[model samples]
Target: MQTRTALSLVAIAALTACASQPMRAPFSQADLPAAVQVPAGHTVVMETAAAGDITYQCRAKKDMAGQFEWVFVGPDAGLKDRSGKVIGKYYGPPATWENNDGSKVTATQLAVAPNGAANIPLQLVKANPAMGMGAMQGVSYIQRVATVSGIAPASTCAKANEGANQLVRYTADYIFYKAM
Candidate 1:
């Protein structure tokens, strides 16, 4: 009986181990979806995730109150899943440059990687949609002043492309827009 019990325990342990084994995150950076057409003066910066996903950022303006938050002009920002469904939109609280209190940038869309993950660990947030159902994601847009040190990454580290602010850490996929 003792031997039987030991065998069962071993089997349970093995199953537990298998369940917890980590897999390399399965996300990859694809070309930006075609629907997202930044104007002639705009450029998109892609942030590659080690696991296989990409994030994007855009240039934006601050409101008169010194906060720059999305007011949802028409619809929430939209994103497509790998299978090409309009999976979800990106939302977050207001942000600003590290100083001066008013340079705000908002996340407009997220690729909505499956399994509620970014292919890596990330700081996340979201809002309540009508039914109290909402979505969240790793931030794709962020704001920083030219004076804010360390927004750029060092060239040699494994995660050299990552940055940390007083509030969050993320890899930036930037989009620079200019007028034609």
Candidate 2:
């Protein structure tokens, strides 16, 4: 029984170590679905898990019958690897990547899909070389995929929460690609 317990503890420790390391694997570009377009010469360099909120603020839409509605402004999330080290962050102007090494890149949307029953969309993102370095050095694109959860309540447009910030929890995979 003592030997069995020792082995179990070792197994658990190994799993924990594997779960806490940063992921720097090369992902196959071909694995990307047709919806995610890789720019010419770009290849997937790293893939991280993003767990955070899609922030919303109640605002008066220009054409929504004078009623306020929840508008998706941006994401406030932490980016982690399979090993669980925080590699970056997502926030600002619809989409952005800020790495731990002080590299930051804002992306332009190339393709998007209506994700599910929710009204929000999933996106294919591209970054500029001039915008980042270090961990994000040379990164040219990212695909937001494998989304499991994260969408704001449609009922939040009510007067009670008007002009206030709301955070909708979500999780997704962020695959980073670089120009090779």
In order, the Cα lDDT scores of the candidates are 0.29, 0.78
lDDT of 1 at 103: 23
Predicted candidate 1 versus true structure: per-residue lDDT over 50-103, tens digit per residue: 111122222133443332222222112233433345443322333211111222
Error of 2 at 30 (Å): 5.2
Worst 10 residues of 2 by lDDT: 24-33
Q: Model 2, 117-172: lDDT tens per residue?
A: 65345578777663645877787888887776567666658666678887888888
Off by over 4 Å in 2: 1-33, 118-120, 130-132
lDDT of 1: 0.29
TM-scores, all candidates, are 0.21, 0.76
Backbone clash total for model 1 is 8
Evaluate residue 124 in candidate 2 and report its C-alpha lDDT on the 0 to 100 scale.
88
Segments in model 1 whose C-alpha atoms lie over 4 Å from true places: 1-30, 40-92, 97-117, 120-169
